[model samples]
Target: MMRAILPTRALVPIAGLWRVTACMAGAALFLSACGATTGGPGVTPGPASPVVGAPPEPAVLGVEMSPERLAFTPPHLEGMDLVRVGVLLPFSGASAALRSEAGHLLRAAELALFERGIENVVLLPKDTEGTARGAEAAAEAAIADGADMIIGPLLAAEVRAVSGPARRSNIPVISFSTDTSVAGGGVYLLSFPPEEEVRRVVSYTAALGADRFAIVAPATPYGQLVSQAYRSAAAEFGGTVTAEEVYSGGVDSMSQAARRLARAGIGSLEVGRALAMTGEDWRPTDSGAFQVVMLPAGGDDLRMLAPSMLFADIDPLLVKFVGTGLWRNPDSAREPALANGWFAGPDAEMRARFETAYEIAFSEQPSRLAGLGYDAASLAVVMAASEGGIDRAVIEDPNGFLGVDGLFRLRADGTVERGLALYTIRRGQFEVLDPAPVRFGPDSMAVDVEPGES
Candidate 1:
């Protein structure tokens, strides 16, 4: 029942059926290729051809992949065209945790083929081993194997390492790195960047007439990024960040920061508590030092931060609370202090369907990043079926494509923009306060202007 929101040309089928042949043993480079086909009644399966090559070495780029790990290759049919998609991930690494994550990403990509009913596309997974040199080697192997398009190489450093080889081969890459610096020149980032989330939520809050803002964030790198993004978003939306506080360390530091922020904005804790005692309603449009406070943490950090603000006597009823995509967790709704707090994220309904489908297919909950792999593979399928094939023009189409994470477009600059929905924590649930836009406007880039830019 899942339908794609794409142009008519993207749905057109390519001429000729194609099959994937098994990787021959003793090949120079060993790739675990996985191909999917849509079989129907009255269609006879074609015979598979043996891909003869040298046996695999003990290790490729210091990452060992045993034959047992490659045994999941599906049988292929002969005399069919092929659209080879090279998926580079840290399949083997010093960290076992990262290897597990890579497994989830690869599984998600494989799931996209069957779910989309794609018959001609084949997935060629290469192990990056979680290093720049490994990623460069993987990219070289994939390019040498005639990959039509490349997906992943998750880390920013890995993306940078793969970019040169991909450009030299005229192959486009859809990476999962959030670092905007690594984007552009045929490397499109499919990962969620904090800038877009901050922009959306801040714009929405400003539209509600909250002009004065305050921020309470941690001192981590992510917090710094979100803080900078918040400032830019606020200025662009005609709001002023009147006060800010950055804390490091544990819950005590966070609580102290919140208290400091409260004093800076509302004078004293006693006054804020006295103000809360009044049964009078406080609206965003009302004149005050600050009408909204931005908290960009998630999980346990969020659990502690939200209550810290409340304990500082910053009444949630009087001051609006805004956050980024990190607030999408169900646990955020369970926190009584966060009730009525607003955050921006993907379309809830679409994400719910995707999560359900992924859980059913994998028998476990998929990680938040798994959607990037699914969407990247889905893009490959659409491009392969299209008349234009997989190229920069087809990929950078202004119309964009809708996927599991909702509507998103790969910009010519290789940065991605997503249509997000505003949600509020309510009654132990996250409820959509503003639904996500179904499509991009004619001038989608108009809102992407940075602060202080003409």
Candidate 2:
């Protein structure tokens, strides 16, 4: 199940259906092209089998891709002074199921080098098979091959396994896992975290005079993370949590929770209308308790919960709705109640541009995670060509790099900080409410005026 095409030099191997073809671009440049195939492995026939060729899972903050759009190409470098880059990915064993997705990631990295025409860099892709042991073996093999840097091992467990080896060798590893626990010790996490999203959006809303906040989250691990993030962000951003509620993933639990939260600012009449079955008389409060309510859910869950809040006598116009990166979906924008709601996420325009370029060059669509490969490789190329190649100071630039998603920088603790923009849900779309800051500072430019300023 492997194929190789050697034009002038042996290029990297890509799994799945791809045909290698090359055409000379210039005297010093050559383009090794590959034809993309949309048809994937057919579903196994059995009672337990899922519907054959069902649509793939919905991608975050991006359009759903059809099989008709899948394509790929392997990049080959041509030069004397080679900057060896070790790429650790799950290419075999149990993780072999993800080979198709991994192919797209590798293609993205190749596209970065091809676009930059970085002839001096050579990519060595190793198979981790998506396990801790596999990751360890891959790292050892990569180090033995003299890789100057490592750029993958997608899962947090895999990253953890490679961290010790990578640190011991003094070879910096930039991982794709979002789990911050695995970060540090020469391994950088490039994946987006919910806590960071909460910090950014909550801070933006708090700066807008929202002194009080409330959170309604599911009783799940992710919900707990968002809950903690809201608490921490509210304190840091000059706000307080007026009320917090966690509910099981259902309408009844959420409705009950909403009723309790609505009681914070509900009048006697509104209370009776919303909770007539309570059989207990209620009176009005200050009505100025919480200025904003955050729901860290998305898709159908959000669509249902938003209306439940309205049904619970909480006026959307009075208390603004705030959400996390989950609200960046196209479906969420269509919710009438979500209009004017704010959330923090990547720059959609730039991300769209990258997707378009990817589709055109590879004749295929890319997954959301593909952006990491491109960004990581781009960072390596820039650093490799700099005065001190891959210098710690250079990679950890405080000013950050302008990526496809927007501005981002690596921290000393191996955590990534992105300059994410605040977006407002509009009618069937999302509008940029506050442009992301270019750098980390109080004086950074904001698209809108400061809170309470006319």
- lDDT by residue for model 2 (67-164), tens: 23121112332224566677787766374447766667766776666554455665656667788987887777666655778889898899999998
* TM-scores for every predicted model: 0.80, 0.76
Query: 124, model 1: CA deviation in Å?
Result: 0.8
Q: In order, what lDDT does every prediction score? A: 0.72, 0.67
Span of ten consecutive residues with least summed lDDT in model 2: 1-10
TM-score of 1: 0.80
| Model 2 lDDT at residue 256 | 91
Local accuracy of candidate 1 as per-residue lDDT tens digits, 177-245: 999999999999998899999899889878878888999988988999998998898999998899899
RMSD of 1: 9.2
lDDT value, candidate 2, whole model: 0.67
Off by over 4 Å in 2: 1-79, 93-97, 265-286, 441-454
Off by over 4 Å in 1: 1-79, 267-282, 442-454
Q: Which candidate's lDDT is highest? A: 1
